[model samples]
Target: MKKHLIAITLILLLIAGGVIFYLAQGDKAKLAAGADTGKEPVFTAPRSELIPTINVAEVKVWTAGEKPVAAKGLALARFADGLAHPRSMLVLPNGDILVAETNSPPRPSGGLVDRVMNYLMNKAGAGVPSANRITLLRDADGDGRAEVKTPFLTGLNSPYGMALVDGTLYVANTDALMAFPYKEGETRITAKGRKILNLPANAPNMHWTKSLTAGPTGLLYVGVGSNSNIAEDGLEGEANRAAVLEVNPRTGDYRIYASGLRNPVGLAFEPKSGALWGVVNERDMLGSDLVPDYLTRIEFGGFYGWPWNYWGGYEDRRVQPQRPEVREYTKRPDYALGNHVAPLGLAFADKVKIGGAFANGAFVGLHGSWNRKPAAGYKVVFVPFAANGEVSKAKPVDVLTGFLDADGHARGRPVDVAGDAKGALLVSDDVGGVIWRVTGGK
Candidate 1:
C-alpha cells in the first residue's frame, strides 16, 4: 500500500510540471521586433510567469577564419584576438585602443532563483572568472589590424567603462570610480590608481557593469544599475541604485543625475545637443515582450519609471507599495530598441568613415537576449541621426551580424562599440574573446 501511494504522488507531480511548462510557452510575441520599437513600443498585458523563459544561446568559440558578417558596403576583420572577456573599449587620441577585458564580480545571494541563473551563466560560458585588466591594441600602419598588443592596466575589479579627459584616465569598476594619470602614446600604466568615489555595489550586485563617460562639462557620468529585477529583494535594498551619477573629477563628490533607470549600461552625450543619453535594460519576468529596453536623452532630475512603472506610465502591478502619483511624472524614453536586447554599448558617429546610412548615427551593440523565444539582438545595429544629432524615425539597420550561427549557438557576443581615430568601428566580443573591426566597403 505504501508503494502504491508513492507512485500516485509521483504521477501527480509530473502532471503539474507539464502544465507549468505549457503555460510558460503559451504566450508568444504578438508583434515583430520593429513594431515594438520607436518612442512608443507595443506593450501587451503583463503575463507574469512562475518560471521565466530560458533561451540562452550556447556559447561556441569562433573557429579559425570565422568572423561576423558585416553589412553591405562594410567589411569585417579580426582586429585583435585571444582576449579574456573584453567588455568595453576606448580609442586614445594617439590611435591606441584600450580594451577592458573583464567580467562580473562575485554574485550575492538572492535565493534559489539566483542559484539557478548562476548555473545557466556557467553553461553559457559567462561564468568564467573576471580577467580584471585593460589591454592596449595598436595598429601602427593603419591596416585595420592590431599588431602591437600590451597589457595597459592591471589589478582592476571587473572594470567595464573607460574614458580619458585631459591628462587623467577614468575607469568605472564594479564598486568604485578610479582615476590614473595618463600620457599620450603610453603603452601601459604601472602607476597606482586612486578611488574617486564609491558606487552602489552591495552583495547581489546583479547588474554589475558600471559604464562611464566623460562629459564636456568636466563631469564624469557613471551608469549604475539596479540591484534586483523590479526590487524583488525589497525597496530598502535599492538605495542609490538604478540611477545615473554625476561625479566631480577633482573632489570625488557625486549626485544622482537622473533616477529610475533600471540598468543604464551605455552612457553617452548627443553630439549636437550635448545632452546626456543612455541605453537602458529594463526589468524581466513580465513576459518576453512587455518591457522594451530603450535609448533616451537623459534629463537632469528626471525619472524614467522602474519598479513602479515602465515606458512612462504603465504601472507594473508586481512592485509592492505602488507609487501611483510618481507615475504622473515618469518620462518616456526617446526610442525603443526592442525588448530584452540587452543593449550594452552606445557610440555616436562623429566623423564616420563607414559612409551611407551609417555615416551620421548611433552604433549600438546589442548583447543579445536570454529570456525570449527565437532570441533577439545578437548583433550591432545603426540608428540614423539627422545633422542636428537627433535620431531619425528610421528602423535600426544591421551593422554587424552572424554572432549566432544557423544552429543558434553564439560564436561571439558583442558588448561595446566605439570609433577609432581613423573612423573605423570597433566591437568587443566577450564570449568569443575577440575584438572585431568594421571598415567601409571598397
Candidate 2:
C-alpha cells in the first residue's frame, strides 16, 4: 500500500512539472515595438496569464577589458568602475559628477508573492543592499575615465535623483526631498541636509525611483510611481503616487504637477520648447505587447489613466471597481517607447558636444525587461527630434549595445543618463557597477 501511495505522488509531480513547462512558453512578441518611437506604436490586445512569463537574464559582471558596443562614429569607455549599484547622476558646473548608488529599501511585510518576486530580483542582480550614499567621480583631465573617486555625501535613505540650483544641492531620497549647501570643486559635503518635504514612500515601495529635475524657474519636479501595479493595494495607497510633483525649493511648498503616470522614471526639459518631458514605464503582465512605455510632454492637471485605463482609453478589465468616467479624460502619451523596454534614463542632446545624430535628440537608457519573452531593451538608444523640440517619426537608434550576450545574460543594466561638463553622454549601469562614457568616434 505504501508503494502504491509513492507511485501516485510521483505521477502528480510529473503532471505539475509538465504543466509549468507548457505555460513557460508564454507569449512571443510579434513586433519590435521598442525599436520604433514617436507616435503610433503598434498595440496588441491584452493576453493575461495565470503565471507571468519569467525570462529574466542572468547577471554576469564584466570580466575585464570588456565593454558595450557603441554606434557608428561613436566610442565607449569606462568612466568610473568598481562602484556599488549606481542609479542616477548629476554633473556640477565645476566638472565634477555625483552618482547616487542605491537600491530599494527593505519591505518586511511584502507578503508571499512579493517574497517570490524578490527572489527573482536577486537573480537579476538587483537584490543588493541599498548603499544610501552618493559618490563623486571627477574626469578632470577628460580622458574618458574618472581618476578621483570619493564619497561626496554619506548616510541617507535610498537616494535616486539629484540636482544643483544656485548654491544648494538637492537630493530626492525615497521618503523625502533634502538639500545641502554647496560650493564648487568640493569633494565632500560635511553639512547635514535640511528636509524640504516628505515624499510618498512606505514599505513595499514597488516603484521607488524618485527622479528629480530642476525647472528653470526655481521649482523642482519629481517623478513618483504607483505603489502597486494597477492599484492592487487599493486607491488609498496611491495618494501622491503615479504623479509628478512640483515643489518650490525656497518655501517648501509643493503640489501635484501632473497625474496618472504609472511609473515615471526619467525627467527632462526639452531645450528648444522648454517643455517638461518624462519617460514613463507603463504597467506590465498584459502579455508581451499590450501596453507600451512612453515619452510625453507633461501638462498641468493631466491624467494618463492608471487602474481605470491605459494608452488613451483602453480599459484594463483586470482592475476591479473600475471608474468609467475617468476614461473620458485620459490623456494620450506623446510617443510610445514599446512594450516592456523599461526606459529609465532621459537626456536631451541639444548642447552635447558630440556631433552627428546624437547632437540634437533624446538619449534613453532602457534597463531591459524580465517579463517579456525574447527580451527587449538592454542598451541605450537615441531618438531624434526636430528643431521645434518635437520628436521625429523615426525609429530609435541604438547608441549602446552588447549588454547582453548571445545567451541573454546581462553584463550591465543602464539606469540613468546625463551629460557631463564636456557634453559627453554619461550612463549609470547599476548591475555592473560602472558609469559608461560615450563620445564621438575616434
lDDT of 1 by residue, 345-428 (tens): 999888457887787878999999888877888999988777887877888889999999999999999999999888889999
Range of the 10 consecutive residues with the lowest summed lDDT in candidate 2: 107-116
Candidates in order, TM-scores: namely 0.93, 0.93
The window of 10 residues in a row where model 1 has the poorest summed lDDT is: 108-117
lDDT of 2 by residue, 1-442 (tens): 9999768755655565455447867588877545435688877778977776667898998977998988889878899999999999988888888999899998552344555566668879999999999999987787879999999999989999898999999999999999999999889999999999999996578889899999999799999999988998688989999999999999999999999999999999999999999999998778887688888889989999887898889999989988899998999998887788899999999646677767777999999988888888899988888878998888788999999998889999988988888878899999999999988877
lDDT of each: 0.87, 0.87
lDDT of 1: 0.87
* Cα RMSD for candidates in order: 4.5, 4.3
Q: What is the C-alpha RMSD, rounded to one decimal, of candidate 1?
A: 4.5
Clashes by residue pair, model 1: 108-204
